[model samples]
Target: MNLIDTVRIALRALLKNKMRAALTILGVVIGIAAVTTIVSIGQGASRLVQGEFQTLGTNMILVLPGNTKRGGVRQGGAPTLTSVDADLIGQQCPEVLASSAVVWTQGQVIYGNENWNPKEMLGVGPDFLTVRNWQLEAGGFFCSSDIESNAKVCVIGHTLIPKLFQTTNPIGQLIRINNVPFRVIGILEKKGANMVGDDQDNVVLMPHTTVRKRINGSPLDNVHAIMVSARSTGKMNVATKQINSLMLERHEISPGDEPDFTVQDTTEIAEALGMITGTLTLMLSAIAGISLLVGGVGIMNIMLVSVTERTREIGIRMAIGARGKDILRQFLIESVVLSCIGGVIGLVLGTGASVGATVLINMYKPGTQWPIVVSIPAAIVAIAFAAAVGVFFGYYPARRASRLDPIDALRYE
Candidate 1:
């Protein structure tokens, strides 16, 4: 028989056992659907992480306190970094554009009769918001005079707006932090959350001088961290090294002594986090791949049963002039056709499921925007995998049918 004739006959046989054929195809459908859904979710998760990082800042480098060992035990926490260190790096490092020193604190903030406690009250320089890539939603950011005068002016995040001011306009309003009054100057634009689920919009900002001398009761020179903006993404490494060297010199650490502070390149932190998420996505895809393997086995089991049931039909076809290879070709075509039908249905189902998942996540989390995308390459590969499964499983049964004894099969009633 010609290839077309063989395929037609194979299709007819499958149509004759409609219920069995549908069952056989179900396995492939389930497997392919699982794979595509997994791949889509993994890709979406990667985009979400990247977006979260870029939301709060761009090209930011952090200077943090380093740990020191006492005898065999780790004791001292990060040495206090100061505004002086930030200024030196800004002046000496050609790769740096701007820098800000942060003094971190927390206390109850009261606006009129309303009292709300914020998680962080940041003491920062005027350049901190610029370095962080944060924009104002209302009013203007404090200027250089605000820092120099040790101004008790502040910027509040969006999430804290409702809690502190309610329906009233917060701009120009006076609020008290631990009874230390501050005039509301600007409202920070909304930034949802970080990877660790911490609220990025739940803090407040003030000059480092005000925070140190007034609220925290610490010396005006004390700071917890320094945020530096690199001239460009490409210059981040150079800026970090220069900052590190300048810090060592200012702290008077000798060549063999451990540094008092640590300089962290934000670009490196972002790259490392990306790698971790990518690995997690890969592992999830692999786990979903197990379903595809199981589906292939189902095809093999059903094919074996088909070979046994069609023994007499095969014998009659041979007696009537059909070649063994033609019988093999017919059965193989039937298996492949079933897999193809299943794969098409699976592609649609998987795409819909992925979209639904994205919507649900955004709806529940609120403010967390997630992407919904179907990978065309992954769908194409899944279909190709289904075809491969058909061939590998159908071959054994096809061979078995071709080897059957004509007289024995014909006499089997």
Candidate 2:
């Protein structure tokens, strides 16, 4: 028979056993759907991490206190970052555009008869908002005059304003932090949560001098972290190296000893996190793909039974002068048809599920570009894998049917 004739006959036979064929195809569909959905989630997560880091700040460097390792052991607790290091880096690093030292105090805010139980009160220099690329929707950010004068002025983030002031205009309102009064000078633009779920919008910024002297009761020169902005993306490496050397000198670290600080660039952190998430996605997709192998084995078993049940028919075909290879080709076509049907269904279902999830995430967080892209490579892989399963599992049964004895097959019940 011609290839088309063989395929027509095979399809007719399969159509007669509709339920069995459908059941066999179900395995391939399930396996493909699972793998595709998992990979989609992985891709979404990678985008989220990158967005979160970028929102934190661009081309920025975070200098935190303490050496990364202590006594050959990695440090566990948050170490103290002093204002001296922040000053030195600002003065000595030619590639650095701006820098700030941050001191924070957790406290309650009260205005009139209203009181906020707890709020994140940040003590930062005037350049903090600028380095962070924060924009104000209502009033101006803190100025050098505010920092130098130890002004008791505050800037509140979007979420914090709603919580403390409700529908009232928070600008020019007086909110007391730890019973200390400060005028609200600015309202920061909304910055939504990051991938790890940090509330970037719930914060209050005050002058570093004010936070040090009035709230935390710490010295004016003390700081917990230093944020530095490089002159440009290309200048980050030169800036980081200069800052490290300057810190080592100021801290009096020996040539063989590690410096008493750690410097991290935001872009570098972003790339590293991307690689980690990509690897994780690949692993998860691989695990889900194992189900495809199981489905292939199931196909093999079903085809084997199909061959046995059709032994008499095979014998008749052989007796009618059909060659062994013709019988083999017919059976192989049946298996391939089954797999192809499953693959088509799976592709549709997987793409639908991925798009649905992307929609939900975007709705919850605006400006989040979680696109549900159909991966051509993944679709090709799925289809090719399904075809491969058909061949691997159908070969034995096809060979068995082809090898049947003509006279015995025709006489069999």
Candidate 3:
């Protein structure tokens, strides 16, 4: 028989037992769906992490305090790094283009009887936005004069606009941070969430001196951390080493002793996280691959059963001058069709699941935007794997059907 006629006959046979055929394809469908969903989630997570790090700009360096070992253990309470340290780093380190010292705290912000707590209330310099590559969505950044004069002026993040300002112009409007009044000078563009799950947009920025002296009862000298941007990517390491050496000298730390502060490149931290995420993606894919293998086993079991059940039909075809190879081809086609159809159904289900998952995650994580990404190559590979499974599993059964003796098959009840 021609290939088309053979396929038609094979399909008609499967149609006779629709329930059996469906049950047989169920495993394949489930396996493929799981793979596609996992791959999509992995890709989405990678993109989210990369975007978050990229926002901090290139050739960035971060310095934090209180890592000094006192009695063989680091002091743990609060950062000991101060604003003077940041200033000195900028002056001494030629590779550093700009530097910003930040003192972080949190307090309820109130406007017109409405109150909401920002995710972050940070004390920073005019260079803070420059180091972080952040831009004002409206108005302008608080100027250097604001920091120098200890002005009661602040910039608010995009998330705060809807909550506190709400359709009104926020610039020049007074908002109370812990009941301490400050004028909003600018609105920051949306930054979304970072890899640590912190909401970057839900923040308020003020001059470090103002926040230290006014909002919190702290000495004007203390700062929690410092952010520095290098002039070139190649100079990041150079800047970090110089900053480390300068900090050591400024702090009077001995060689081979733990320094009171730490200097690190932001890109290095990002690269580390990228490696971790890549490993996680690979692990997830491997788990999904296992499911695909289990589905192949199901195909083999069903094909074996089918060959036995159709023995009589096989016998009649053989008696009517059909060759062994023809019998084998017919059974193999049936298996492939069933598996391919199941794979298609799985692709639809997996894509839908990925979208739904992204939506669900975004709902729980306000200010976070996770994209739904389905890889076309991955989809093609999945489908191809499903078809290959069908062939591998159906071969033994198809060969059995082809080899049956016509007389014995006919004589059997």
Candidate 4:
């Protein structure tokens, strides 16, 4: 028989037992669907994380308080960083473009009849806006004069507008932080959220001097952290080393001794998070792949059973002068057609599932930008792999049927 005839015969045989064929195909469908859904979701989550990091400035770096040890006892978060250190870093570190001393507190902010509690009330230097690469929606940032004179001026984030100001313009208006009145000089542009889902816009920024002397009553020299920006992306490592060396010398610490502060850059943090997400994606994909293996085994079992049930038919075909290789080809084609059908169905279901998952995530998070990304290459590969599975599993069964003795097979039936 010709190739066309063999395929037609194979299809007709499978159609004779539609229920059995469907049960076998369902196994492959489940396998392909699982793999596709997992890979698509994993890739989407990775993209979301990367986007969040990019939303924050890429060249930013943070100088935070490290652990301190005194008389063999370790203490968490020593108050060692200061405004002077921030200034020195800006002036001395060639790779550092700007630096800001930051102090923070949390309290109720009152404007007229409205009162709101923001996520952060920050005391930052004049260069804070430069270091963070933040922009003002209206008015302008505080200048050096404000820091020197300890001016009672502050900037508000976009989220605070609806909570406190209503329709009134926030700029040039008076708001009280912990009951201490300050004029709002600037309004920050909106930033939705960070990687960890913290609302970035629920904040208030004032000069470090004002926050130290007026609001919190902390020492003017002490600061909670120092924020800095590297001159360029390539200069981040050099800037970190320069800051570390300057801090060690300024603090009078030895070369091998542990310092009282730590330096961290956004580049390193982004890479670390990417690594974690990538590893998780790969691990989950592998777990999903197990289903594909199970499906292949199921195909083999069904094909072997088919060979036994069709033994008499195989004898009649051989008696009618059908070649062994022809018989094998027909069986192999039947198995491939079965798997390809399942693969197509699975691809459609998987794509739908990915989109549904994205919708569900957005519903829970509200403003999150979770995406549905179906890979075309992955879909094509899945279908091809399904075909390969059919060939591998059906070969033994087809060979057994092809090798049967014609006269003995016909007599047995």
Candidate 5:
């Protein structure tokens, strides 16, 4: 038969037994859906991780407190970063553009009758916003004079403002932190949650001096950590090394002895996190791929049954000058049609599922936008795999149909 004629015959055959055809294609639908959904989730995760890191900026170094040990060995002491170290680094390191020593205290914040107990309460220098690249959405960060003079001013995060103040213009309003009052100066532009689920939005920033004098009751000498930013990407390594060496010298650490503080590059940390997330994506995709193979097997089983049921029909067609290749083509096309139909259905379902999953994930994590990305290559591969299953599974059935004797088929039924 001609290709078009063969397709028409195949469609009639499948239409004649609608439930059986649907059952045969069920495997393909499931396999395609699983594969497509997995790829979408993987791509979404990779994009989310990359975007999250991008917001933190590039070529930035964070000097954090405490030391890491190995094998039950005492490795180091807590980081005792002070304003003096921050000033020294800013003066000595040419690669460093801005440096800030950060201190913090958590307290109950009250605006009128509303109150909040946010976890992330920070005391930062005037240069903190500059070094960390934080932008103001509503007002401004405190000035150098504010930190030096211990001004009772604060900048609230997007999440903090609504929870405590309730749609009020937070600027110029006084809020009490642990019963100590501070005027609202600015509202920070919203930054979404990081991988650790820490509330990047629910924070309150105050001057380092105010934290020391009013909140902490400690001398204005020590800090929790130092944040530093390089002028360009090229200067990152040099800046880190310079800061490390400077700390070692200041702390009087000798060669082969570990330093007290840890200087971490945000870019490297981001790359490492990306690698981990990427690996997880691949693993999930692989697991989903197994379903496709199962679907292929189902196609084979159904094709064999079809050959058995239509044995007499096959004999008559062969008797009427039909070649074995023509018979083969007819059966193969039937399987392929089933697969293609299933693939289309699966594509719709997979896309919808991925979008729904992304929406739900975003709802739980505000400002973290994860988009459901359709993988074109994955779709193409799925279609190709369906065609391949048709060829592989339809072959034996087609051959069995073609090999039947014409006289015997006429006599049997």
Candidate 6:
């Protein structure tokens, strides 16, 4: 028989047992839907993380104090990094564009009767805003004079506005940190949240000198970390290496010995996060793929049953001069058609599910920007895999049906 005639006959046979065919397709649908949804969501999450990093500027590098070793025991991070190190890094590293020493403290911010606790209060150098690539909503950032003279001026993130100033203008207003009054010099533009959902706007920035001397009571040179910005994206690695070498030389650590500081660039951090997300996506995709195997098994089982049930019909066709190859083709086509239908339905459902999931997540976290990313290649592959599953599992049953003895099948009840 021609392929079209054979397909028509096979479809007619399935139509006679519509409920059975529908149930058989259910397994495939569930499997494909799960895989598609997982892949799409994974892609979206990866993109979101990369985008967050991009916002922070990929050319940025962070230098933090490393662990201290005493009596063969390792201690937590030591306060070895200082403002001098930050200054030297900017001056010595040719690839570095700017560097800022950062000192961190936590205190209640008060303005008149209103009092609020910020997530972080930082002492940063004059180049802090430049290194961070942050913009001002109003006023201006602290300059060299502010840091040099330890001026009591500060910049506040957007989130602190409602807590301290309400609807009143924040510029030039006095806000107290640990009862130490600081004149508001700038209002930072809103940064929303980081990739890990930390509120980026709930911060206060001051000169590193002011934070150390006035609030934390640390030495003039003391700093918690150093932030560096490379001259260009391609210079990040060179800048990181230069900083690391310069730090070791300054800290009096010998080459190949454990240094008391760590230099890490944003590119490395972004890659690490991307790797983590990619691994998770792969693991989840593998778990979801198990459903496809189960569905394949279901197809095999149902096809075997179909072969048995259609034995009489098969025998009549064989007796009427139908060939075994034609019978096999007909049965195989039926199975593929069934799986293809399920695959198409599942693709649609999975795409919708991914979008709905993103919307729900964004709704839950109002400022979040979870995205829906449906990969066309993934959809096409899912459908093709379903068709392949049909062929692989349907082969044995089709063979059995094709090989039925005409005399024996014709006499069967």
Best by TM-score: 6
TM-score-superior candidate, 1 or 5: 1
- State, as a TM-score between 0 and 1, how close model 2 is to the true structure: 0.80
| Candidate 1, residue 228: how far the Cα is off, in Å | 2.6
Q: What local lDDT does model 5 show for residue 224?
A: 87
How accurate locally is residue 254 in candidate 2, as Cα lDDT from 0 to 100?
86
The predicted structure with the larger lDDT, 1 or 4, is: 4
Q: Model 5: clashing residue pairs?
A: none
Which wins on TM-score, candidate 3 or candidate 4? 4
Quick one: best lDDT, which candidate? 6
Candidate 1 vs. true structure, TM-score = 0.86
List, residue by residue over 326-406, the lDDT tens digit for candidate 6. 999999998898889889988999899999999998888766688779999999999999999899988999998898899
Weakest 10 consecutive residues, lDDT, candidate 2? 75-84
> In candidate 4, how many Å is residue 354 off?
2.4
- Residue 39, model 5: lDDT of 80
- Measured with C-alpha atoms, the lDDT of residue 103 in candidate 5 is 87
The residue-by-residue lDDT of candidate 4 on 1-413, one tens digit each, is 99999989999999999998899888789888887888788788878877776666648889998888899788887798989999999999999999999998888999999999999899998888888778889998898899999999999999999999999998899998888989999999898876466889999999999898888787548899999899999999999999999999998888777889999988887778878877887787778777777877888889888888888888999988999999999889988988888888888898889889989987787667687799898899989988988898878888887888888778764
- Candidate 6, pairs of clashing residues: none
| Total backbone clashes of candidate 4, pairs 3 or more residues apart or in separate chains | 0
Clashing pairs in 3: none
Q: 2 or 5: which has the higher lDDT?
A: 2
Query: Each candidate: how many clashes?
Result: 1, 0, 0, 0, 0, 0
Q: What local distance difference test score does each model get?
A: 0.84, 0.82, 0.86, 0.87, 0.82, 0.89
